[model samples]
Target: MKGGKIGESGGLTFWLASPGDYDDVMAISDGIYEGNDYLPHRYHSWMTEPYRVVILAKRDGKLVGLASGLIVDGGSTVFLEGMRVCSREQGRGFAGVIQRFTDQYIRQLYPNVRMKRLVRGEDPRPEKLAKFSLLAKRAILSLQIEAKAFHAFLSTLRAKLEHETGTGSLEQESRLVVLEEEQLRHILLDPGVSSQIELPGHMIIQDWQPLKLVESNFEVLRRRNLTWLADSLEQPTFLSLHTPPYPIPYKGGSFRFSIDLFGTKADLACRALLAHMEMVRGAPQLFQDPQTGGTCC
Candidate 1:
């Protein structure tokens, strides 16, 4: 059913997402997360953030597909972080349809964003033991997870996903699932772990730091710094990046991303940040200012 008549199906309509659409999108998303042990819980935040384009395709008014993300790298990178057409609609060629519309819209709205990147992958931990983060397990398991294993897991999974999809989508999926850089620090704050080895059991993570596990090789902080700079300098910029040294909520020994405004155009920087700030300030309750970075992260 490649390139099947999609628009002709008239029942299909693509539009921007509304608050009312969360329930519908979540229904499918939650099912996908639960059905597969490999999937993580990042979308809970992704959906709530602004600058994220939520494009939904409805068939006979029933939601059938969802594409969500934002312009990044100073609108030079339109990251297609998540794109899913219902499994039922897969072969109907609707995925390509949504992709086309999304790509075009980004081009119109944010002319600078470059290529789209998507991610997909599996959990390296055995299904049963996947949740435990070595840092937390030290007190209980008495053995920190081999950070080397973390590196190997990331390298292998990334390579494998790229091989499988023949594109970067798999890598995108992997990033989308786990905690972002700031969220990693936030996760470390959870009071879930306290004192010594007692049992050998499957660990249930309150928040996983999978992204942090990749930062060592990815140079995420440096990349984010460069991205922040680009966004501040570019025209009609759309940018998103995580803040670092993000400590516990109350602890607050500040770690933040700083933009050297030295030669940057202040007007564009301020406007872009302000627009993003306003956009996110309107998000659902599940999202808060801290996690969303209030404007810049």
Candidate 2:
């Protein structure tokens, strides 16, 4: 997306995001998502990504609001994310103004974009969002474990999985298969293989980022450091993707671990989940976080 002056309205001026606006944007985004906002981690790259737009709102030369959209699915769909407004500037309709600005900008610049998509945490009323159609709803589980106690936690978890599944170490190892980024790209691109893979709404959503099985979309997915897993390469019955834990603002030095599991095999799903956690546990010091002066995996 290009960074330039957008339309001004009622003392508010909109513009595309630039690298220098990082601090101002983060200033107003405090406490967002209860300290789990992903904007800080993705802002810089979002500015440089192709076919992606990040719009900002300013009043009297001060940044106050922000929104972003990514054009994907061969320019037929735009995924909206990272919409925010300053703490003191909320409840004044700046957020909606930013979105509407983005809407017109897409129309003028990216006429190829047709569908607009987003993920909301709360259930919305049908009358309020009549223009949008619901694709699917998901239930999420969150766990909190201190870094010092994570190993013990994993040990206990492994024991429970073993006891419930009646599987020893060797047998469990033989039951799981891990795929590389390129391999996953190849697998998803194969029409026959992807047609056979199970998905709700037939969509591949990695942590709320809806993805299409197109070559360009696959390149966008490759930007993240992820672990791909499946039951078998020849004919996979289950699939999973894991992103390494990264520091969050919850406790000042804590990390958030995320997992996206696919397929419906009850026992196989359990094995895949454990396998992903163990993969992270095996390398506790993978990524370096400058703020904490420590490593997170």
Candidate 3:
């Protein structure tokens, strides 16, 4: 679509994103997701992928918002990965303006595609779901494990793995390894193996389903660094380690983990378990007990 003025302000313009828009797009995303590092890398990948569409809104030459969507499920589904307006531009009707514009753009490009977005309970603006014609189909119960419980669970699981393999402890390992999809599946979904260990968190299993794969020019499984993994063909996926209460309050704080698991439940229990281990192994101090003021093992 041709770029043009968006509103009476005349300062806002909407257009399809190009390679040059990466920095501006990321700047807007950083503000919206609270300085997430994962999106920037995936945004670069998306710019080259044929199955993705990125729309950007700029106000008087500065980027103010963006909407990224992927054509998935064999071109029958349009998955809206993210949509956000900069903090300064929010509440001034920019959201609805961008949302309406993006919807029209997608309909023209993929008229038969069913649009969807995985909405989290903690999503800042739940009202935005209506813009994409997305409705609540199901609720996945996400568990928030306490620091102590998570530590204990990782300790037990690590001991079990070491005992079975006759290998040294994984605790000393400070690197993150990108597991092959099959290797991850075996490690996480094998009922006989994981059931042996007493997992600490409250047990809640979301229903599992095979994710629809869409080809991307980027190698989603490849790791750009030791600390993160991306494993999706249709959607931009990321598994990264970061500390909680972000913008890291102090130099040696406890570590936390975050991942983008857009809707498809593929061994979340295993992912969460491993994520805790990742934080412990990679950045132990971040997991320190806030009250007792003790560092993680």
Candidate 4:
């Protein structure tokens, strides 16, 4: 908790967050995101991540604000996430103070990180949009389910879909395929796939992260634990990236899943979504909190 010249501009002392700050940071974060917050699961791990810093604000030794920034895209862009302020400090503008502190820290640490990027659940106003280039936008949907009945629910959904479509044993396997992690770079960066698949805004947005399809970014992409699927490895009609489910603080406890599909064909995208769903239904590691039946949406 090194502090002295912290938040001089806003009269709040700011410093880099450490594992010791977990309880304090989380105490103020209670009920954030309507109890579906992701920070609880990511805080500890975020401290170990390179090119990232979790900034905290304190007044008279009390934790009041928190924000984080990470240098991604080969140190060319800084992505901000998990920004929060204690309820007592909300109306006092401490949120903006911590944000500026994080920004200044990242700037000094990574002078090459010229671009600032962030993902917002709500749409921004015209003035806010004018400062940042409009990268890409996606519609998000939510669902809820029980942890004990997780696999069963997935199985039921798959069975119902197959029964309705009459694809009991064939339609999907013959149409969709998953590529090995080793094949990701070759498959995704291939001229053929790039030419065939629609790269929205010519950028790769996964988990709300915008990355350019370049060689430098491949290493970063590989770390995301993404599962890649396409119609064909040689010449793909559609592609999808699935991020396995992870825990969140929603309705007590829960897991979060994401599917990013690239293609203009509505029918093919639907098929790919179903295929991805079937692929993860049997993965036991994703949701193991049996006592807590959670939301899948």
Number of the top lDDT candidate = 2
Q: Which pairs of residues collide in candidate 3? A: 253-285, 253-286, 254-285, 254-286, 254-287, 255-286, 255-287
Per-model CA lDDT versus the true structure: 0.41, 0.78, 0.49, 0.75
Tens-digit lDDT track for model 2 on 249-277?
Answer: 66565577678887878777777777787
Candidates' RMSD to native? 20.4, 2.6, 10.2, 2.7
Q: Could you give candidate 4's per-residue lDDT for residues 81-116 as a string of tens digits?
A: 888888987888777777777888889889998899
Model 4, CA-based lDDT: 0.75
Candidate whose TM-score is highest: 2
Alpha carbon RMSD to native, model 3: 10.2
Deviating ranges (above 4 Å) for candidate 1 = 1-11, 33-50, 122-297
RMSD of 1: 20.4
Candidates in order, TM-scores: namely 0.38, 0.91, 0.50, 0.88
State the lDDT at 267 in candidate 4.
58
Q: Please, what are the lDDT tens digits per residue for candidate 3 over residues 1-297?
A: 223443323356777777777667656665443333345545666777666788888887788888777665556766565678887888899877876777677777888777554444454465665554433343343333445576676677767655754547543433334555544434333443223332212111112111232222112222222233323322222232222222211222332233323323343333534664545444544444573222222
The ten-residue window of minimal lDDT in model 3 covers 200-209
Shift in Å, residue 142, candidate 4:
1.3
